[model samples]
Target: MSDVPPPWLPEDIDETFDPLEHADIEPSPETPLIVTPRGGDREVGRSCYQVDTQHGRYLVDCGLSQGTSDKFPDLRGLQPQSIDAVFLTHAHVDHCGGLPVLENRNLLADNAPVVTTPPTASIASLMLEDSLKIHRRETDGSSAVQQFTSRDVAEVCDRFHTVGYGGGRIEGVAPVSDVEPAIFQLGNTAHLLGSAWVVIQTSGYRVCFSGDLGGRATHLPDMSPPPESGLLMLESTYGDTHSHPSLSGARTGLWEDIERAIQTREPVLIPTFAIGRAQTILLIIAERLHTLSADLRDRVEIVLDGMAVEGTDIYHEYVEDTNYFAESLVNRVVESGETEPFFAESFTIPETDQDRQKILTRAARDGTVPVIISPSGMLTGGNSPRYLAEFTARFGNASVFLTGYQAANTTGRTLQSQYQADQETVSATIDATPFSTDWPESSDVQWVHAENTGDSELKTRISFSADWISLVEGLSGHAAQSGLLSFARTVAPDTIGLIHGPDYAQERLGPHLAENVAGVDQVTRSRRMTPIAVGSETDVDTAVISPEEIDSTGYTELEDQIDHLYELLSKLNEEVASARNEPGLSEAEIREVIQDEMEIKE
Candidate 1:
């Protein structure tokens, strides 16, 4: 939230917020208080939150993740017309990328005055258009699912309205218009160029939503959580202390690993987010190779897959609120390019088919002394997979390096599967909640190694799931988590609902006032389907919240649905067992595992 008032805000501060402020907003304990996390829970990124009161409704960040394609918030599901307004926190694809897709959707009403600060609005437009372009390129001319194209994104600009760090306005409409009702205050979270931590104020309640807490005082500004809040929806990206590694430590470790891989004369593969991490990794690599140690220099061959060079520009434009590392990273890529003709003036960008082929050919060679960098940070869907298929064939002494938070069910997560070579074939359904237990064993992962084609040694790479990277970055950008907690504690809400991060992160986040987040009380959450929890007893449709009670109102029904599958599979397994040596593993044995997992579900 900046000092300037958005066109949507009312001129009268104490007078009252717009009624449209709470469109489609759910009910909350604070006369008008309502908090609903649309995405980023029990998973990572694509975060959206709704704050509503009987008076009005307003949304804080409306982005998407893999799950966004699911029924509710996708272009098809959301009634954009009903949304009163939208507040953007930052420009990260996960946090702000989904807005444009809203245009493609059919809406109940059709106007949410997509409100955001100037910087965030400008940058998100550009980043989202780029994302749409890439998505279309990959989708074979079909309607790219869950992606917004440049034209669609351009349409979004018309909806673009401005807000400052303090408070902006979107005037017109009654305090209790047809739109849901609520009041929201947003301030810079400093997580990125224009990130913001949201504050929801209702007639009788107050809640502070910690969008995505940034890290400690890194190169960027440190954010502190508000001192008190009736309800605190904080992101525990770094909830566990284990995630507390200094950036310097990560930098040092990354260098050691890269140097070792290069020594064997193999390419070092790093799959990173085009938004931020990709450049950060390169700068660190350059610093380690050039300025830090001379031995680290020559062996390092840097190669890029796509428009990562352009992404550096996006980060550069927002340098004021961004960290020194990100700002300097743009400059670093330029200097590194100037180091030699291949990268410097003669930059061999992969625009045409032939260019892409060359980039791949060079990076795939055994003696090809280069560090190949690509976008699709989590390796979910990008050129990274193509390289893996090509280079790993020969067992080159190479490795794949991952440096972003991988969303569930994505190709990024699939890479961790143990059995692989030219192709991957394994799928085990996972329980999304209760974090620690869900992390598949390290053995299940296929380690990166060099494929040797006679004398040529092509190296695959290692992976890094920077789980705490968000938490740490969020802390520094928002007020420190401590400051935010103060605001939550003060609000003293009767019911607190948590959303917008992996379940592990929320599970790890203790209540700002020492209570457990999922430990009963009035709250609602979902992994795949819907689970609604209510505090007050008056509502007929809502379930009552009891202390120490873990709400699972629909758990039984969902379990039954899952059970049905297990039962069929079990029967199939028995029949398949009749065939002693069958292709694709005994159907019966596969059934057994499903049956066993089903039992565990109960």
Candidate 2:
């Protein structure tokens, strides 16, 4: 991504590290390519795709859609039992959250080999375990039978077949049952630590799946050079438009906000995703702190909250093995075995209420300012809500910096919209627990009033006299419109299928791909269940690609398993009702028996 290594990078590593050039990749060409997008078409989540050939059936990235009702991929017409393998791109929940559920429910082949980079395997373990814990707490047993348990996630991790990027090493070519042998290789996409663009050779053709390609380098890895493919399935998360602040501009904007907060002795609050975004923020602050004045540095403190602490630890864990991190920083942490080497310079990770109160009290003192980084980047949940309630409403002593995208329906988006409203007219539910719990108005505290200047949309910064809020860009993991187009042109696939983006993104990227890639037979934007047959000259739009025509033994098996589970549960419920109605058993006796049974099960 850069010809010259930044000053922060170690001198030992090569500036031009192209992982693709030396890859010993070999592609086999077959015919009758069939692709059915199970999810992540015309939307940004639940990104699963089914690719079928005479050789095998493959499921790519079984993710969950984050929404009012979270959705898993539509495996309606395919049998999970027939799936030869599961290939994961990265560990982002939206891209890989459904794996444990699928495998646990027998929707996937029994202990099917899951292939991904090593770092991704670790990250996915953390995310999956965290998700199940959080889900159980949130639902409080109100939901139906669990799809997967923590034990199931542990099993999934044990079954992961790890692979490394570059050097053309094809992993998992062994045939699963009668399925034809297939080979897959991973290349760094630079989207996240272990993120990669997969190239699978099967069915006599090479298929490339761009699993969230990153357009530019941040503190993480750089995008690998494009690999040749007969059929290309690309992500269009940022394909609709290319206009956004440059990484440098974003950094400058954040720095200005921090400087202002420092001068005013006000605290700064940054809401970010714990995984990628928070790590980037920490790297930025750690690198820049050396340039600050001694007095300012002593007076300022940086705090991490939520999953960011664990995510940052994982970042350091991979420092020695991955090129994405600076070697100097990695060596320091590695040598000292410090969970957070950056914390040596006034950084805090509050564990209890007392710790938080102490930090808040210290920040309230004159000449001392604290910068807080919290999670659930969208502000829909996590510690960010608490921080936002405390900081954003204040005038003259604080600022909020949104460092990434704010998807619709999220609190982050609501805050952004309110910031753009003409007056303090846009009301929102902050849902923060006030510092003084005994306050009489605490129960009624949901609405927050902030004077909006209504100019946030015109630019990144919104000023309201002494207080402000800014939207900083260049933190997005997806490639820009031109970047996606250029990547497609470089790959120059015979057929292209777009997914993992909104309708607007797909609509814009499809034409751009068709125009840019010469001799392209078709560039189709896929919706759920839409099949784009590879090596077929027929126009995809007019083609009748029915679900029945596709060999979906995998989805069929999944359906049967689900039906069986439901039948079993229904029978148990009926039995329980019959027992309750039995003449010999009193109501009290029945209740006691059911409670005893539940305890026994537990």
Candidate 3:
């Protein structure tokens, strides 16, 4: 629960400066809404935007881009003190990674709390703390010193005001002497844990911000639709193309790859992100294995390592207790007679050094293929590299399957490209080694085994050439072209401001939006840090229509159907209660009756 005031009425606001109700003071003239992109306009990373109106100045996001010399958002020529509020959509580094920098500079106003969902508040804290550790290691002696401390992350947590999606409105920035107070509401974007689509409303204007929107439902909830507004700020991560495979297809493909690896006794390495991607992969593996051959399924071991283990735990906690999912989905989970999905049967959470040693040793020695899913998907850092080094050398019985995007110039991308080149005996050398002797500059340290600890200083090497498979299915978090267009139609805003995409993506989407998307007057392809005029025609009807008002009958019918199902289930439960008194009734009979009543067949 956050201490921030819920939707403040005119009376609840400051008595000294009531912009809405003071008859004596004339309302401030509507200023042309100025949007300045400090980062993430034309580029794909470091997303930070400043939305300045006559009433308030708000920051949608502040983040750092990976694989760039200038990672942090450009904060020059901007006064952080002037900004009223910071709203974070999700916990991903590209969206919320630059918070520590802002905090370090004391840029945020004291009253302006970092506003976001509860899950995001928790996950962001974890991400920021982890980022701090990573930054400290990389920037130890470099000119780019680590900016914020662990204490800064703690302070961030303290300042977070957790609000649920589609809940009561939370006041963003307090109304100043003349500026009107901006009110904000969050809705699920289905991108990751606690990802949200935001709508901000002030007098005479409304704007919607789509922060990393997802199209289809995953293990998590489906994306909530953004309300129609005068101005829509949308993400175009995959707007250029619509070639992503379906979730079912991606799962089946990955399962087939794993099955082939198992048949050949080849160790399969699944490099993935610690959060959503890793958890989704685990569930997919667990569910798909029921159809697999008994021998192959029994032989496979799913080893969970690195930060993914922590992320999975967090996911389970929220999914079980909170409104993190749709009401219908939550009801289904409860009615299905299972509290949690069956994942523990195959997944292994190794705790100690000895436990990890057993997994690695068994993977190398046995005929059974171990599917090792490790973190740091890009191969820039984490346990995935260690596993890649260990297994990639054995070309005959090893495979590295990438399950996400590989950023350019990253070690993951390099490996992906090298594998595609069909070069024999490909070598990957790591600089750091356990042994501390000064080796010659020309010598490559070859790490034979993780446990092999001799006086010899050798670089970690992958001598054998193994072809790496890049699986894009179920990999990306952003919505594809079809999904984007669907969202655009649902919102039907007057103007669209596109950001968070490459040049080609925006180019393709801009034309599509102009011709096909109705009610859109203009589709602007945003560049870095350029102020665009929006909400100029404030009189235009841009207010979002309530769905209840339009489709009350359809909504009622759906509710009636759900109620009917519950009634049938309840009757089945009553039968079971009565059957308990009879000795002849069996468990199979009870289940059969329940399924029959529910119109389900095995």
lDDT of 3: 0.65
If both were scored by lDDT, which would come out higher, candidate 1 or candidate 3? 3
Q: Which candidate comes out best when scored by TM-score?
A: 3
lDDT by residue (425-500, candidate 3, tens digit) is 4565554332123221222235443325554545465555545455455556777766676677777977787889
Better model by lDDT: candidate 1 vs candidate 2: 2
Predicted candidate 1 versus true structure: per-residue lDDT over 350-464, tens digit per residue: 5654564455456555354567687766554556655444444333345666665555566556554432322333322221111122222333223233334343333333333
lDDT score, candidate 2: 0.65
- Please, what's the RMSD in Å of model 1? 17.6
lDDT of 1: 0.48
Quote model 2's TM-score: 0.76
Query: How well is each residue in 1-602 modelled by candidate 2, as lDDT tens digits?
Result: 11233232234534232211112111124244556776787678889887665656677898886654456676643544767677899999888888877767566565567788888988888888777875565556456445577877887777687778852323243336444555677888878888988877654567788998874444454467767787788999877765333454455457667867776787888989888878767766775676678878888888998788888778767776545553444555577676564343568898875676677767765557888898878876777876655543333447778888898887778778877664443335543554444212232234334336343222111223223567777656666765676667667787777888887877666765665566666676675655665653334442232322333222233232333333224324433432343213333344345546455342
Q: Which ten residues in a row have the lowest lDDT in candidate 3?
A: 1-10
For model 2 the local lDDT of residue 411 reads: 73
Segments in model 3 whose C-alpha atoms lie over 4 Å from true places = 1-28, 68-70, 167-179, 326-332, 336-342, 352-354, 393-396, 431-459, 468-474, 537-602
| Global lDDT scores for all candidate models | 0.48, 0.65, 0.65
